[model samples]
Target: MKPYNFRRNPKPLTPNDIENGKNFNEVLKAAGKPPLITPSALKWMGIGLSSLAVLLGLYFGLSNNTEPETSFVQPLGPVPFTSALINPEKDTLLHLSTGSTIFIPAFSVVNKDGTPSKGPVEIKYREFRNVGDILLAGIPMTFDSNEARYHFESSGMFELLAFSGDNPLMVAPGKNITVRMASLNSKDSYNQYYLDTIAKNWVPLGKDNKLFYTGDSVEVGNLKGQNLSKENWEPIKPVVLNPKAQQFRIEVDPKEFPEIAVFGETIFEVVPSEIAYDPATAELPWSDVSIERTAEKDYFLISFSGNGQTLKILARPVVSKSNYVKEMARYEELYKNYLRLEKLQAQSGPTAILEKELSRYKALENQRVADMERAAFVEGRNNTNKSVVYSVFSVQQFGIFNSDYPLKLPNARILQPVFAFENGKQIPATQYFLAEMGRNNLYTFKGGDKIQFDSEVSNLLVVLLNDGSVGLFPASEFGKIPSHAREYKFVLEKVETSELSSKKILSMFNI
Candidate 1:
């Protein structure tokens, strides 16, 4: 076989090899070697490719994650709770610093098993009076009625709870506690509502009766007291003839000196003992004399002035001896009546106060008895008076109660907001709040939600940013937004959560 060459004829260079521009030497070297990739090398190559695929997958997965990092429904700080201890065996009246009052009837609280609870049950109460308080408390102010959602324009809102030795107590059946909640808003349009925690909704009770007094009524009561004080009159002193003292008679003007107007034909007697009076001043030939009332009752500052010089003397009004005798006789009878009236008032003042307090409890007791007889869950009475405005409600359960009017969101303008920092850095917000300047309603919304508000009304927007900072769109900017604009871009001012306070937040909203 012609000394057969051990090297098999190298495969003929294919068209692909020529097109690939492979040199003849490289092709020959490739043919002479065993297959460059062995099983072991292939295994290693497979492992390397798998590792690269996993790293790429992880990179894309994290980049696409869109979940919120943190959600904050409440304010940064804790909401404080006020507590008071009360004996369940007796009716207790609790007063709060906010001027709210709670009247708990005897045996109103019961054990979980429905038996009456004993000992001093601690009553815990708190109030949310402003936008900041409500937001910090995370209390929902929205009301859903008849498939329509509304916001609560609150007059006042409060929460109440009772406990005994760390055990929660329930309100006794057929019994209710009365709450006289002081309200800043004196409007009569609000209705009472109790928050149903289990259902997470507000249950409308009825119209809230507002008790308030007019300024005219208060003035009438004050006038009656003034009239009584005027009825108890005293006699004036008679003018005594003194050879050394100078005295003069003057026709007193009723309008100018109304204090001594009742005494007819009065004479001005100089009081030498007064420190402000100078006896030498009486000798001046005064061109004009003017009388000015002094701090002392029935006394006057008699001034004589002429040629740019003024002389003032202390003087008092006095009646003649005969007039004094006639006035004194009438005064004696009036004084006797005044003494009798004073004695009666002294004896009755404390008794009247005690009776007034007792009457309140008695009235409450009567109402409680009547409610029990009818087996009613709640009972309310309208105790209107000329005093403070009180929004009263009776609760058969321990929970949050509110006096509010449900208001629909303003539909004059609707917007889809895109929140960004003043520096144009976009922030993701999970929730936001809208507060109108004059209205006590707080409208809240979720992310990707449409915000509807009246453009004419001053409004404030607050958003809890994803980076754990507060973003505020102030009220001043509300007027700058075009009414017809649908998509609004809000340039927010970033505020550190630590620097925020209830007063500061309220001031920002102009509450």
Candidate 2:
């Protein structure tokens, strides 16, 4: 090789050398076009995709946010009945104080009977002194199908003789005890009105009077069950007689008197204040507080500042008697209108009576609730208690329906289960299951045929077969029934499980 000129002479180039030094513009001219994308172009595309991702995230992230409503309702303190509002704190307070009763305050007092329950219906705390209204006697009792209530009505006379009810005061026409004197006072707690009496110088004629009134008084709860007997009325102190007492209340502990229970010992206080209640409905759906029956009366003796306490007196049915007088009073007032309207839109006397009883304060337009109840009560009093009970049942069902679904049991572990037919297997022979079956078409079982359900069998229950009926007898009482049907079909109509009644099952059907 010749001696190279260091600065001027380039090296004799290889093919790689020529390609490396070549201008990009010249190369593009040689090739048809440049490569598809430059580095800058790729960078821009990635940036664009990143921006799109960012936008999507923002949209989804904000989607959960909501605009609140402009306004909301504020509770105006306690509602009409002061007793109804209960501070949840009362529960805690009850546990803290054992000497004083943990008052339930006011709850939904569902009426037990339809005929306006009459007073003088007694819940006997003892032989001599009557406590409260157990089952008011003559109060024209009936169910208002429309209102769904057990209505106590008046039968012209206030005492049991005319149309009596269970007397709250056990005193009667000519008994050992005599009411020497009586006084009455009318006062009300809300828009609701009330009346009560005060007795003085009452005497018992029998020799046992001393023992009946005196002696060691039974403890609060025990006094109810003919628990004690005493003599010497002067020294003994009775709850009703002590006028200037603190609370004017009856304090009883449930632990002692277990016999009188509500809802089968689970609960007992079944006082129905508004309209109607079921012996079946022992416990409230919303409340789990256990209640017990005290003297079978529906009234509550709520003690306050002194012995003069609030008496939540039971409403008696004066409907039948009152309705007659009501009509007679307003006969001429609406008769001409009835004549003009052909009685198609006549004003019956019950309208006024209803207005007086339920919708006294609320305007007629807004008093549809009270008005409807009155009309229904009047209509049903003449019929059966079934109609009245059905209405109350409907309301209870409605309450249950509107409430949170799938009611849970008192013990959270076990759910409140409704019995339903699972397998095609049979059930315990009971009256309701086949109440309305026709008398003509039914099977009668012989002694050997009794199907006993035991642990061994696990599934079968003994059934009693009878004319036009089928009964599900509990396996425990096997085969002793001479002639029985687990179910029934009565004379007036066909019976079905849906039509069974407790009274009928025990009384009419001989279940």
Candidate 3:
């Protein structure tokens, strides 16, 4: 069988052609030699033609196998062109008072074909915390040829979500920008970093502020003193996450420990850890200490010299070192002043003026002692302890001093009633306000106040009152009040910290 060939003569063989071939063969015979179309020659031609056909088919098949075949790839879906995108290069932790802005580089939404994807880009933001993540409004970013921008007004971790219409295109890791107190100078400031078990990384918080971490532990100390860089951080203690509870309110029932009765009309308040009191004035008359925990383990019964009054305090489980630091400074200053006054009194003895001045100095001297006791009580946080708690004794009675009173009861109020504004209304004592706390300024509008400002232009104000109350309010500027606001419009509601003496006694003894 001859191999099929397309490129050949168009005309088919005819009988005249065969006859011409036979005449040519006869001429070749007249010259000499055998006939041209012999049986052996025909047989050899058939075998040779068959072998050629097999070789041609094998050559084409092997050539196809040597090189890869080209085909179109069906895209899984529209892909975000992350290759050209860049995240924020600035440090996530910010100490800006007016807040900060971050720029997200322009990135294209491309399809499998490497062409720009069809649809509008939407950017969403939210406040990130260890316990709860707050979701904010999603706005369509003003794309300047694919780039977008964002700003933060408060301190916290913020996350970004970018989408091409309904489909999620990309998500940016949390970008943290913290706003600090405007009055505070950052030259001497430092941050306390914690181990974020959720993220498996170390996170930073302002050293002066109290925070609730959901992680197993957090490392806290002066970054410089500890020689801790971001990579070398470690946890100071394990953090027990209280998901359902955010704060604890401190309440005192003096009847349980009536031994504290000598201090009549005594108002109790929880002091911050920062205060240092005079030691001589802080001596306790009673002498047994018994600390117990409730069944739910939410509250602790801290009895000082069990013989004294037992105060029931509800407080979150977290300690703040800033309080202790501040109190120590006050303690040292007052002690030095008291020593100088004593020397002056000795030099100018027997005079009425010197005596009166000495008496006043003595009162201040007693208060400093109380401060030291309170500071010591709150600053003792073991690895398993929760938050810091203390009591300040303010005397309402001015008569002769009672010998039974717990040595020298401090004249200062540690825990003041904190107020908050929720849903455009004033709410009382919602958050346990820490005394001597500082932050960026904020404002709060009480009922009946017609003050109005462009909410868009207004910022939060950190209001620190003389009574040691700190709160956030909506305002226009840091120090000034909002415009169109009356001077007396802002009502500072009195924080009711404790129950009446009679009522507390009755409840304690079940009268």
Candidate 4:
């Protein structure tokens, strides 16, 4: 049977002489089968060529991502202080600082003159916990501190976003700055490495002291006892992100158990496993020491900024080493006595009154559990302040005692300005101010400020400048801060901690 044949319509072409076309085909056929090629071989060749093209394209495309196609012409101005860019993951970006910061997620970093620098911050994107991933994107970094501005030239492949909020210094212009690599890779540093490449930069705070180098800004100042390689080569330390961003007015919550944190010196401020337990014994302050005990169930901390401005999550519910058993041992022993005495009701018969007494013993046992719950120092996640809470210290500033713990200072009316921030964007509902008892002191300060003497409690002297500027001069640079500094910034001075004599209480019992 003849099958119906179908053919696609041929595309129109310039008509050629049939005779000439046949002659050409005949001549070619006569030429030893014309070295015909197989369709499979042709297909493989096409595929190989295509794969090679893609590989070459990707190599050059990534390498030349940010590089200018044009020759090294006149360099472009720096990215504008106000301009910003973010990575594909939507992390905020930054650049040179005029002394402020911003939190908007941006994409490309434009120059001050409105142009992007040549070259794709060509870093591969990937991420690793101990190490970051490759194929990361780009990130803009900018900050201003002291008198210098720092700019970072970087790719955000695995990079993290530094813009958490408003920072005036990050957006401010006017300083020499350089971004280093060590600030980006330390286990404690801020940025995340997406894949293989790291893109970043740093801007210094002063004109003459702008950052002169950068590689992977490590931010190594906070890592103590850590043997980290500087940018993998140089023996330099990374600087803190916001070493001196001051907040004029701030607030805090004292009842809020603070989540342990360390800014410029340590990795973690609190280690839950290191929690110390009180003695594991129960005493009635009398001769009664017998009691039953129970096992501790769980433990945690709920720290809050003063005034409930912020609620921070601390330790989760975890098994904690506790003395709950030893302390409650007395309850069991007393209850047993009451029960044993009941069996004697037929013999000596004191069960009724004894049961009542036994009840009291049981009550005490229950009290221990209540005490354990009350033993919590901080609040819980259930109760959080919806206001902004700026971290504050108990004392304005606390320094060293004698030589090592010495707090250095220059002539200024104010000795310590601990709770100060530059731009706004703070934890709401928190408040702060310089606390000068009964009266405020005036002072002045300048570069090269140092300590003269060291005394922990001796008050500093205030020096009036010829220009009407007041300065605080540390009388003893080696003095210790007020004792009992537990968290952000509160301390108990010797005077505050001193107990006073009581008379009414002494007479309450007719003593």
Highest TM-score among the candidates is held by which one? 1
Query: How does residue 321 of candidate 1 score in lDDT?
Result: 65
Candidate 1 lDDT (Cα, whole model)? 0.64
Q: What local lDDT score does residue 376 receive in model 4, on the 0 to 100 scale?
A: 25
Error of 1 at 29 (Å): 75
- Score candidate 3 by TM-score against the native: 0.18
Q: Largest lDDT belongs to which candidate?
A: 1
What's the TM-score of every candidate structure?
Answer: 0.52, 0.16, 0.18, 0.15
Model 2, C-alpha of 142: deviation from truth (Å): 34
List model 4 lDDT by residue over 1-511, tens digit each: 6687766887655456544456766777775342433322221111122232353333333332233221111111111112233331221212222211122212233233434323222111111111001101112123223554332222111122112122111211221111211111111112211111111123211111011111111112221112211111111122222222211111222112111110112111111221231111111122221111001001122332333233222212111124224323433444455456445565865456556645553454344334323432234311212101111001111110000000123223223322211232121111111111111111112221222222323343322222222222232321344433322211211111012111211111121
Model 4: CA > 4 A from native: 1-57, 60-132, 135-511
Clashes of 2: 79
Q: Which of 1 and 3 is the better model by TM-score? A: 1
**Cα lDDT of model 2 by residue, 1-511, tens digit:** 8778567776788999988997988878855442334322222111122232342333233222231321111110111100122221111111101111122212211123423223322111100000001011101122223333221111111111111232111222221111110001001100100111111111111111000100111111111122221110111111121122112113334333322111111111222332233332322232222222212122222211223322121211111232344434444444444355434324443344434533432332233334334654566432322221100001110000000011111111111111113243333222121111111011112222222222222111212222322333332332343333443211122234234333223232222
lDDT of 2 at 96: 9
- Which is the better candidate, 1 or 3, if ranked by lDDT? 1
What would the per-residue lDDT of candidate 1 be over residues 172-226, giving only the tens digit for each residue? 9988787767755555568889876545578998887543322111111111111
Candidate order by lDDT, decreasing, is 1, 3, 4, 2
The per-residue C-alpha lDDT of model 2 at residue 281 equals 32
lDDT for model 4, please: 0.22
